[model samples]
Target: MRAETGTRARRPAGPGLISKVGIILVGIVFFFPFIWMFASSLKPSLEVFSSGGSLLGSRLEWSNYSSVWTAVPFARILVNSFLVAAAGALLAVTVSLLSAYAFSRLQFRYRDRLFLVFLGTLVLPQEVLVIPLYIMASRAQMVDTYAALILPFAFGAFGAFMLRQFLLTLPRDYEEAARIDGAGQLRILVHVIAPLLRAPLAVVGAFLFIEYWNSFLWPLIVINDQDMATLPLGLQMFSGERGTDWGPLMAAATLAVVPSLLIVVAMQKQLANGVNLGGFGGR
Candidate 1:
């Protein structure tokens, strides 16, 4: 009996080791680009192009960072990026939470059908909407303004869907108890449910922030002024009409990526908890 038990334990242990190895391998594969970008940012322009140095061989040339700053209005771009991202995230989360609550807890005629219509928007690519959205923005005289960038993405179907799914998993007991105590819907949502929903809200906010931070397409189309351009658009100017300057380009890329990386690292635990907690409730 003892020998048989040992064999069963050892069999599962073999697969566990294999799974760990596979996960490590995948992580390395995914992280390689960022590693390379950091390394390249440290290399001189000539060294960056040269194939001779080891990935970690070159001494860190910190001057590339200074050169990058001088090469572009990175500070302004950073501010613009921050504003757009922050505003978009705030609006998206606020709207999504309310919408999710309505869909999950409150019932009205054709609610499910309305949700289905909202979800159907997810099927269409953002590219298809760009031209029409741009035209509408032009008509509204919002083309060159921050409103042009922030308003379009303020509410997203994905945010609504994800938050709704998360909200569905929560026990109705808290809401019922709140009502029994004479708490209204808004009061219950603000005092009771919102506090409990923090994990999922954090997850949603983190994702929306990252998405807005990295957005390049719509900003490029609408924002023509240098002062209003986001980091991704400003970085494009560095390429020039001649040839790409790799060192400074890498430097700018590194700077642009830092906020997103930090946000992800900070919220990673919350994101995981949100997803896990959200899994408990059914739609």
Candidate 2:
């Protein structure tokens, strides 16, 4: 009986061990791209694709990063990327929050219909908007301007819809209490509602940041000046029509991943909270 009980106790460990092994395998699969990029960044241009050696460089070319930066005005490109992405994200989030509040809390005629129309825009491919947006910008002489990049992404229907869902999950009693204390709409939204909104707002902001940060097509079409080009354009130029400088390309690509990683890490706790509350919505 002692031996039997010991065997039974050990049986449960099998599935637990299998689950851990599965998770480890999944993590390795997901992390391989990053590993490859970092390894390739240190490789000589020719060695980047060589199959005979190990995954990384046989002799590390550490100078690739420095050389690549000096090859062009990379700092300027990075700054442009940061400015356009950050400005677009902040503006988008602010507009989404206000639109969400109005949609959730206030009553107006044809409000639901208007919201549905907004949602309809979400299903439309962004490619469809390029020509019309370009024409408007061209007529306004806004092409190649920062406004062309930032203004187009400054309002997102998806952000409003997502934030509206989150707002629906918040208690009206909180707003009622704020109102009873003689708080005005703007005051209540600022102090009472905004405080509770951080997690969802972070979620929305993070998505917007990532979207605008990686934006390629719109900027390519609108921006003609080398001075205003973003990181994507810089990377493309690095890989000229003749051939790609793989080592330098990977170095630039690795550097490009930093801001997104930092943003996600900084907001990870709030991001987790937002995801946890996703089923019921959150604010």
Candidate 3:
């Protein structure tokens, strides 16, 4: 009895010294760039490179951030990026929910085949679609518009595939009960299915928002007005004929990362659950 009690009461083993060291090294490797960017943001433009790989400069330059605001119409560009990202995320989620519902629940001929064909689109890179999308947007006269920024890439297969996988894991018992109660497809989707989809929805929304937030090439091709320019395009304002403004550019980049960072942090649990539930882990 004493031996069993002692064994049960013994403290659990913690990570080894080597494991702790490895974790610290891995953390430093992952976090070094952010630390470097923030440190460089406070340095003088010239000192940004001449600081001999040191994190700090000769002195702190708070003006770098103020320069970011005055050097370009940053506030407007920030608003525009936020608007586009939010709109794109909403649209993507709505479309994904509908598509996933149809694919996972509905009985139709060639449905799996059609889904496979749709999933094949995931292999197509954004670069290949840009030309055709640009032409379509041009014909629709959506150039230099928020619609152009948010619409072209909104209907991607990624969200649909993710949501569909999640939906497949869900039992049809609730859906069947809702149907027996005379609830329609859309009603069951909205009232019955959607309430259960919070985690996956949050994951999809966060990813789509980040994708739209960081987009540069498509917006560069489509938007002309500085007023309509997103953060990625706006960041280029730091580079002029005089050469690149490193300090202010770093400041702006840091500022740009905040929104997406907050979203990921806020949705951390949902994102983790969604990933695990989406066919990767057993329920």
Candidate 3 lDDT, 133-166, residue by residue in tens: 9999999999999999998888889999888888
Assess every candidate by TM-score: 0.92, 0.92, 0.93
Model 1 misplaced regions, further than 4 Å:
1-11, 50-60, 278-282
lDDT of 2 at 99: 92
Q: List the pairs of residues colliding in candidate 1.
A: 169-281
TM-score of 3: 0.93
RMSD of each: 2.1, 2.5, 2.2
Clashes in each model (backbone N, CA, C under 3 Å)? 1, 0, 0
Q: How do the residues 173-269 of candidate 2 rate in per-residue lDDT, one tens digit apiece?
A: 9899999999999998899988888888888899999999999999999999999999899888777777989889999999999999999999999
> Which has the greatest lDDT?
3
- Residue 196, candidate 3: Cα error in Å is 0.7
Minimal lDDT window, size 10, model 3? 9-18
Indicate which candidate wins on TM-score. Answer: 3
Q: Cα lDDT for residue 134, model 2?
A: 99
Show pairs that collide, candidate 2. none
After best superposition, candidate 2 residue 203: deviation in angstroms? 1.0
Reference-based TM-score, model 1: 0.92
* Residue 127's lDDT in candidate 1: 94
